[model samples]
Each structure stands twice: as C-alpha cells, then as structure tokens.
Target: MPGLDIREIVRAANDRWNAAFNSGDAAAVAALYTSDGTVLPPDHAVVKGTAAIADFWAGFISAGVKDHDIELLDAQDGGDMAYSSGKWWATGLGEDGKALRFEGTIVTIFRRQPDGSWKTCLHTWN
Candidate 1:
C-alpha cells in the first residue's frame, strides 16, 4: 500500500485525545493506545500496559485537568508503524484550588491496528 496520511490520522487522534481528557474520561483516553502501550511521563516511572496507562490518566483527570491542547509538529508513516512529534499544554486546578498549568514537547509512536485504525504504542513528553 501507499504511504499512510499520517498527518491526518494523528490530527484526528489528537482531537479525540483532547476531547477524552477534557471530558475527564480516563478510560476513553487510554482507549487510544495499543494493548501494550507505554507512557513515559515526566519525572515518573514508566507506565506500561493499557491498565497502567488508564490509571495514570485517571490520576490527572481526578486532579481536575482540563483544556488539554496538542499541536502536531511532524508525523511520518513507516508501514505498520509511525511516529509523531508535537507540543501540548493543559490547565488544571491544584489541591489548593489554584490554577495549575503545564506545557511540553511530545513524541509518540503509533501502530496500525488490524482494523486500520492507529493506536499509541509508546508516548513520551516533557
């Protein structure tokens, strides 16, 4: 097959991710990953597998994170695998009810599923 339009695919996936996160649905956010997906969160031990990934997101969602934004910078298809680089930012409320914010660069790998949809295989941001 010809090269996949990874830019479009990632754009749509990012939209879904932002929506899921903003809605505080950690399960929905984790559904964007592959079964064996891994997350390398800043300053934290690596989280492996979908369940752990869901738990990681659940913590953030429960912390009242919102307004998540992802800006895709680059993407390339490599047959069954692909990679994307981007920047992201989000806002949340701290335990003290003060506003908290975060922004960082991100790199993610995606694997094409049997159903022809893309899911995150590895994700890292800082």
Candidate 2:
C-alpha cells in the first residue's frame, strides 16, 4: 500500500484532537487513542487504558471546560509511525464568570493500524 502523507495525517489528527478536547467529553477524547494507549500529562503520572483515560478527562468536562485552540508546529512520518508537536490554549468561564486559561504543547505518536487508519499510541503534554 502507498504510504500516508505525513502532513495530511498530522493535520487530521490535530483537528480530531482539538475537537475531542473542545467537546469536553473525556470519553470522546480518549476514543481518539488505541485500545491500549498511554498519555502523559505535564507533572502528572501516565494514564493508561481506554477507561482510565476517559475518566481522566471527566474532571475537566465536569468543570465545564471549553474553547480549546491547537496549532500544529511540526510533524513527521517514518516507517509505520507518525508524530506531531503542537501548542494549544484553552479558556474556561465559571458560573461566576471567573476565567481560567490553560496553554500547553501536545506531542503525540501514532501507529498505522491494519485497517489503514492511524491511532494514537502515545501522547505527552507540556
């Protein structure tokens, strides 16, 4: 089979990731990963498993997290793998109108599946 384009794949991955986070549904975000995926958030222990990863996002969603923006900085593909690094920022407003801001970079690794779809195998955020 012909190889996937690194740039297009990376763009789609970033878009899907942004959508998942903006949705504020932990399950939705976690669904972007493979079944045995792992995620490392800055200063936090690694989160593994689909269920556990989904649960991890629950807190932010429950707190009404919203408005996430992701900007892709670089991407590369080699063999059966692809990776992308990007910066993201999000804002949240509480019922009392208190504002909160979060900014970070997402570095993700994707593995090509037999079905030709790329799924996240590892993710780390800063």
Q: Say which candidate scores most in lDDT.
A: 1
lDDT for model 2, on a 0 to 1 scale? 0.83
User: On residues 1-126, what C-alpha lDDT tens digit does candidate 1 reach at each position?
Assistant: 236478999988899999998999999999999999999998999999989999999998887788999999999989899999999999988778899898999999999999888999999999
Q: lDDT tens digits, residues 11-112, model 2? A: 887788778888777788888889999988877888998998898877777777778777889988876898988988888776788997878888889988
Off by over 4 Å in 1: 1-4
**How much is 124 displaced in model 2, in angstroms?**
1.0
lDDT of 2 at 22: 80
| TM-score, predicted candidate 1 vs. hidden true structure | 0.93
lDDT of 1 at 70: 94
Where is the poorest 10-residue window by lDDT in model 1? Answer: 1-10
Per model, state how many residue pairs clash: 0, 0
Q: Against the true structure, what is every candidate's RMSD? A: 1.9, 2.3
Cα error, residue 61 of model 1, in Å, equals 0.5
What's the lDDT for all of these models? 0.92, 0.83
Q: What is the lDDT of candidate 1?
A: 0.92
